[model samples]
Target: MGKGAVAAVFALLVVLVLAVVVVLITQGSVAIPLGEVVRVLTGRGAESEITRTIVLDARLPKVVAGLLAGAALAVGGTQMQTLFRNPLADPFVLGVSSGAVLGAAVVILGTGGVGWLAGLGVVSRLGVTGAAVAGAAAVLLIALGIARRVGDPVVVLVVGVMLGYLAGAIVDMLVYYTDPDRLQALATFTRGSVRNVTWDELQIISIACAVVLGLSVYLAQPLNALLLGERYASSLGVNVRRVHFLSLASVAVLSGITTAYCGAIGFVGLAAPHLARGLLRTADHRLILPASALIGAAIVLVAEYIAGGNGLTRTSLPLNSVTAFVGAPVILWVLLSGRSRKQAR
Candidate 1:
């Protein structure tokens, strides 16, 4: 697609996302009307304080978190895919999400406290996010190192899978000795949920998203050059080592933070870039990155709506389940088609 057309489509997607979020806010047991949703959003709703609270205070955070987390993961996935020159590279596949999950589980089960992060205060949330980021960084660093040594993408993917299994094993050991309540708190991390995020955490997410998204934009030129092959990029005067560091570090931070708060919502990082590339008819990072972010945001928001916003079913569906319904198909197609193996060749 032309740049103008791509921009228009992205704009339209954003509008659709906003509409879906509005509809979602008006859903659930209380069922605020569309007019009220608009009014509430506009800060002129005539509804009672309670209704306003439900819409603005309660639902708004979840929706916003879903938007940010989805975008972040998708963009991170795009970067990793490009970095490794592999279509199958994703947050989960790279072991970033698993690493984050392991870190959070260690904190939760070890501390034996209730709720996410196991009764961590704001400072502790930062600590947990840091731990998650460190874990992701560790995995990405190792993966990149292996990618350098290995000629085949399949080998790199297998290495990543082994890393994920190792992290899972550690999490299992932690769960074994932890009390049930703490284990319950850790369970949601594996399941994923935007609803559980706090406004404070939302603030953290927004800041991280803005900073990393901007950085990704700055690095897009270098990333596109990378796809031409490392030697070609080096010939173009791109600092290959620096680019790898910045890209992998940025991906680690984005994936870690999103997983830390939203749980390991899968496939988004893998799927969104493909969708964006398909839509834009190009794999150019400049367009693919932003488009993936917006599409990812839209996907997650819609998924949340389908999963019953705020106990619409008097119970919530885990975000991971809904996402898996969308993501698993993509993964299955990739695996069964043997395209991934072909690409590695």
Candidate 2:
């Protein structure tokens, strides 16, 4: 496809996603009309105050969180996939989510306060966010080390899975020994609710995701070069080590912040890149990274609508489950098709 055609299609996709989000904001159990939704958004409605509260104070932050988290995860996933040279690679493939969950759980359980991890003042939230970032960085460091030495993407992917499992085991052990009340709080972090995120917490996510995603755009060309092979990239004057560090740092921040707020929103990181690649018909990071971000944002917003946690359904589904529904199939396909194995070779 021509560049203009591809750009047009991507632009349309983003508009469609924004439209869907507006529709979703209006059509909850309360059933605000679309006209009112628009009016409230535009500051011209009879129920302006009520509608504004519902849309802005309540739903808007959640929607923003979903959008940023999804885009962050997708961009991180794309970087990881290219760095590892494996379609199955994703942000969580390095156990970042597991580490963040573990860190949050430790804070919640160790402090014996329900809100210790999530409800502390901004200072405490920042503390937890910092911990999550540190944990994710730890995992990323290990995963990158293994990826460099192993040179097999599938093996590295499996190693990351094992790291995640190990992190999970530790978290489970911590939970098993801790107070049950804290477990309840941990539940929200694990289940992945954009709803639990206050506007205050949203700021942290916004800064982190915005900075990381912006950096991803800056790194895109170098990443594309790196994708050709490390030696070739070095020959072309791309600093392989710097690229690796910056990329890993970006992934760490994106995954860590999102997990801290959204609670390990699985598979958007894993699935969105492939979808973007298929849609754009290219793996060149220049286009794929940003396209994945848009698609990821759309997917999360749509999933949030479907999860019905905003009083849209009698029973709400967890965001993790919703993402799993989309992600697990892609994972199975990669495994069964031997694509992962081929990438390893």
Candidate 3:
């Protein structure tokens, strides 16, 4: 894409994100008007106190959670694709998200579910996030270890899928053995939803996302170098080990924190970067990262809107249900287009 075209695409993505944020915040169960939404956001009085509370307290947090989770997942996916040199690689595909869920589940289940975790201080919340990061790190390390030993990206990809299944099976076992009453807390994490996040949790998520995401910018050049292969990247004075470590760290933090807060909302990571790559017509990380972030946020917001944010359904759908539609096709396209094979070579 030309410079002008890229700029236009970015502008459109930003506008779409903002529009969705506005619509989702205002048009929930109560259906506040756009003008009233603006007023409440701007500190001017809303038409009513209930509208203000609903927009500011209830809806705004959910939208922000979706925005942050989407961006984090997308950026992580972008890094994963580059690191693995596989088009289908992502937190979900690589079992990083599953790892995170397992970590949280251990903490949640071991401590006696959400109630016990709640009994602990804010440290417990941070602890959940920490466990999640640890889980993602474990999966990343295992997958990378396999990738190093086996040059075949296809084989590594299958390994990742199996790892994901193993982690999920463990989680299911935990759920099956655990108290039935405690299962209520696991529902959101299993299926994925942003409705349960609080301002406190958002504080942790936002800070973690912002810090890790900002650090990822420094990896762009090294990541771009890696796309040509590890030998080429090393030949260009990029320390392959350092680059891999940093990339995995970035991915771990991003994927782990999002999973901790929002559950394992799938596919945004796998799909958003691909969308950005097509939009920019280049694999440049500098452009792709920001574009993917915006695109990712817009996607989650739109998905949320479609999956009952409009208040059409009594029960809200899981985010994974919507994101899987976008992500699964990308996976098939990557495999069938021979991109996965090419990368493996």
Give every collision pair in model 2.
none
TM-score of 2: 0.93
lDDT of 1 at 141: 85
Q: Which digits, one per residue and each the tens of the lDDT, describe model 2 over residues 50-148?
A: 777888788888888888988999999998888888888886666778888887676667755345445457777776677777778888889878988
Model 3 TM-score relative to the real fold: 0.95
State which candidate, 2 or 3, has the greater TM-score: 3
In candidate 1, the residue pairs with backbone N, CA or C atoms under 3 Å apart (3 or more residues apart, or in different chains) clash, namely none
Q: Clash number for model 1? A: 0
Error of 1 at 174 (Å): 0.3
Error of 3 at 150 (Å): 0.6
Candidate scoring better on lDDT of 1 and 2: 1
The TM-scores, one per candidate, come to 0.92, 0.93, 0.95
When summed lDDT is taken over every stretch of 10 residues in candidate 2, the lowest stretch is 111-120
Error of 3 at 152 (Å): 1.0
Badly placed stretches (over 4 Å) of model 2 are 45-48, 112-120, 336-345
Segments in model 3 whose C-alpha atoms lie over 4 Å from true places? 111-116, 339-345
- Indicate the residue-level lDDT of 104 in model 2: 69
